[model samples]
Target: MELIGQGMEGAVYDLGDGRVRKIWFDRRPDDVRPLKAFLDELPPLPFRTPRIHEITADADGQAVSEEDLLTGTALQESGVAEEQALDAFVAVVEALRATVAGPASKALPVLNQPFWREDLSWGEALAALVRRRAAESRHHFRRDVPDFDNLLETLTTRLATIEPDRLSVVHGDICQPNLLMDGPRTAAVLDWGFYSTAGDNTFDAALAAGFFDMYGPDAQRLDNLLLDRFERLGHDRQRMYLYRAAYAITTATIYDADAGDGHYVWCVGNLNRLPR
Candidate 1:
C-alpha cells in the first residue's frame, strides 16, 4: 500500500488492485453514522463516484474501506475555464439533488436526522460555531482571539428578522480541491466527510467563493456570480450573502484556532470585504 492522501480524520492509500483503502483515526463519533449513510447511498447514484467494496471496522472502531475512483488530475490543477467550472458545479448540485430526492433519501430511523432543509435558523447555526470556538479557545489558551462573540451577536441580530423558508441538502465543504475533473466539462466531487443533513445551500456557495478568493484573482466576481445564481433560484440573495460571509468568518476562526492560530486572519479578511 502507498499513501495517496490524508486529512484530519483518516489517510487513503492505493492498494494496487484498482482499489483504494481509507483508514480512519481519531475521528469524531458523530461522523460514523453520516459516513455509513453516505457510503450506502453513494453506489446507487448514476454518476462517477467511488464504489465502496467493503467496510471494515477495527476493535477500536476505526473505519477501513476498499473503494474505486477514477484516477486523474484534480480539477483545480486542470485550470478549467470559469464557465465550464460553473457548469460542472451545477451538474454536481443536480446529481446531489437527485440522490437526496430519491426514495432512499429518507432520514435513517436509527440516525433520526432530517434532510438538510430550511429548518435551522441562521442565528442558531452561527451560535453553535461561536460556542464551539469559545470552548476551543479556553482549552488551547491561544492569544489574539478574534472577536467571535461580537461577530456572532451581529450575525444573530441580523438573521433573527429574516425568515428562511427554503432549504436543500448541502455539500458542506465544496472547495475546489474536493472536485475531480476528467476534462473541462465533466467532474466528480470527493470527500463526503463534511456533508451535512441540515445546512443552508448558500453557506456552501459562499464556501466555494471563499475557496476561489483564497486562491485566485478577481474572486469577488466569482462570488457575485454564485450569489446571482442562487438569487435566480429564488433564494434571498442579500440574506444568503450575509449568512455566507458570517459562515466564512466563523469557519476561518474555528479552523485557524484548531490549527493553532488563535486569530482568524483569513476569515477576518473575508468578513471585512462584505458589502455594507
Candidate 2:
C-alpha cells in the first residue's frame, strides 16, 4: 500500500486496482459514521466524491475503510493558478449548498467531533468546541497568535450567545485541499469527512477563503480579493473572523505530527487576526 494522503482522523493509502483504504489512527468510528451518512444525502453533485463501501482492518489491525478512488488532480497539489482555483471552489460550494437546501436538520445529516455530535443549538455546539480546543492547545495558541488568551476568552464568550437563524446544508471542510481540479471551470469535491447537521452556511465560504489566504504566495492581494468577492455575496465580512477562528482551533490539532509540519503554526497565525 502506498500512502496517498493523511489527515487528523486517518491516513489514506492506495491499494492498487483503483481501491484506497483510509485507516483511522485513533480507531474512532465517529469520524467514519458522519462521512458515510453525509455523502448519502447529497443530491448528485457535479463533481466526484469517493464511494465508500466497506470498513475492515489492515494487516496490522488498524481500522480500515475502502472507497472507490475517484479520479482528478487535487487542487492543492495541482499547481493551478490561485485565482482560477478559488473561483472554481466558490462555485462548487454554492452549487453544493443549493443541492442540499432544505430545513436545517434535514439538509446535511452529518456530525462533527467534540462539538456537534448531537442535536444542539449552534451556540452550544460551537462553544463546546472552542472550550475543548482552548484547553488542549493553550501552549500552541499562546506561542503563535498575539493575544491568544484574550481571543480564546472573547470567542468562547461571544459564541455562546448566538444561534443560527437560518441553516443550509454545509460541507464543513471545503478548504482548497478538499477540491480536485477536473477542468478550467469544473472541480471534483473530495473528503466529506465532516459535515454539520446545523451550521452557518456562510462560514463554509469563509473557511475556503482562509485556506486560500494562508497558502497564497502573496497574502494581502488574496485577502482583498476574497473580501471583495464574499462581501458582494452579502456575507457579513466581519463575522467571517468568528467562523475562521472556530475552524482554526478545532482543526489545528489534526496532522500536526507532534508539531513537525507547520500547519498548526499557520493556523495559529490566522486564528484571531480579523481583517482590518
Candidate 3:
C-alpha cells in the first residue's frame, strides 16, 4: 500500500486498480458515516466525488473503506502559478453554490439534525460549539484573551443577530488541499467529512475565503475576492469577522493535540482578536 494522504480522522492509501483505501485512525468511520451521506445528497458538483464501494476493517483494527481514486492533480501539489490556482479555487466555490441548490434546510439529513449547534439558526449553536471546544482544550492552549468566557458570550449574541433568510450547503472545509484540479478548473472537491446541512451561504464563503487568504495559494488576490463576494452576497464585514472567529476557534480546539502547529496557532491568534 502506498500512502497518499492523512488527516485528523484517518489515513488514505492507494489500493491499486482505481481503488483507494481509507483506514480510520483517531476518528471512527461510523461517526462520519452520516457526513458522507450528506455529501452524496448535494446536487451534482462541477467536479468528481468518489462513491464509497465497500467498508470493512483493516488488519490494524481500524475501519477501512475502498472508494474511487481521483486522477486529477491535488491542488495543493499542483505546482502551478499561484494566480491560476487561486482563480480555480474561487470558481469552484461559485460552482459549489450552484451544486448544493436544493429544497428546504429542514429536509437535509446531517444538516437537518441541528448538531452543528443547538438551534443552528444563524450561528448561535456554532458559537456555543466553539466555546465548548475552547474550554475542552483550554489546558493545552495558551489563552490569548483576557476574558475568554466574555468573548464566547459576545460571539453567541452577535452571531444570533443575523437570521439567514435562505440556507445553502456549507462545505465545512474549502481550501486548496481539499481540491483536485485539472488546469484552471476544479476537477473534484474531495473530503466530505465536514459537509454542513445548511447555513448562510456567505458564512461558508467567509470561512473558505479566510482560509485561502490565510494559508492557501494567492492570498493577496483572495483578499479582494473574499471582500467582493461577501459584499455581493450582502454579508457585512462584521458578519465575516464573526464567522472567521468561530471558525478559528473551532479549528484551534480540534487541532490542539499539538500546540506547535503554525496553523493551529494562527487559528488561536485570530480567535483571540475577536472583541466582546
Pick the lDDT winner.
2
Q: Against the hidden true structure, what lDDT does model 1 obtain?
A: 0.57
lDDT of 1 by residue, 194-228 (tens): 43443455556556655644545676677677667
Off by over 4 Å in 1: 28-33, 42-46, 50-53, 58-61, 94-127, 134-150, 158-167, 258-263
Return the TM-score for candidate 1, rounded to 2 decimals.
Answer: 0.73
Winner on lDDT between 1 and 3 is 3
Expressed as tens digits, the lDDT of each residue in 158-272 for candidate 2 is 7777665665566777766777776554556776646455467677777767666575577657766776787788777767777778777876866663554667866776674
The lDDT-based order of candidates, best leading, equals 2, 3, 1
Q: Rank the candidates by TM-score, best first.
A: 3, 2, 1
Clashing pairs in 3: 111-197
**Per-residue lDDT of model 3, residues 22-65, tens digit only:** 88884455644555556457777778876677667756656787
Off by over 4 Å in 3: 27-29, 59-61, 99-122, 138-142, 213-225, 272-276
Model 3 vs. true fold: TM? 0.81
Clashes in candidate 1: how many? 1
Model 2 pairs in collision: none
Number of clashing residue pairs, candidate 3: 1
TM-score of every model? Answer: 0.73, 0.79, 0.81
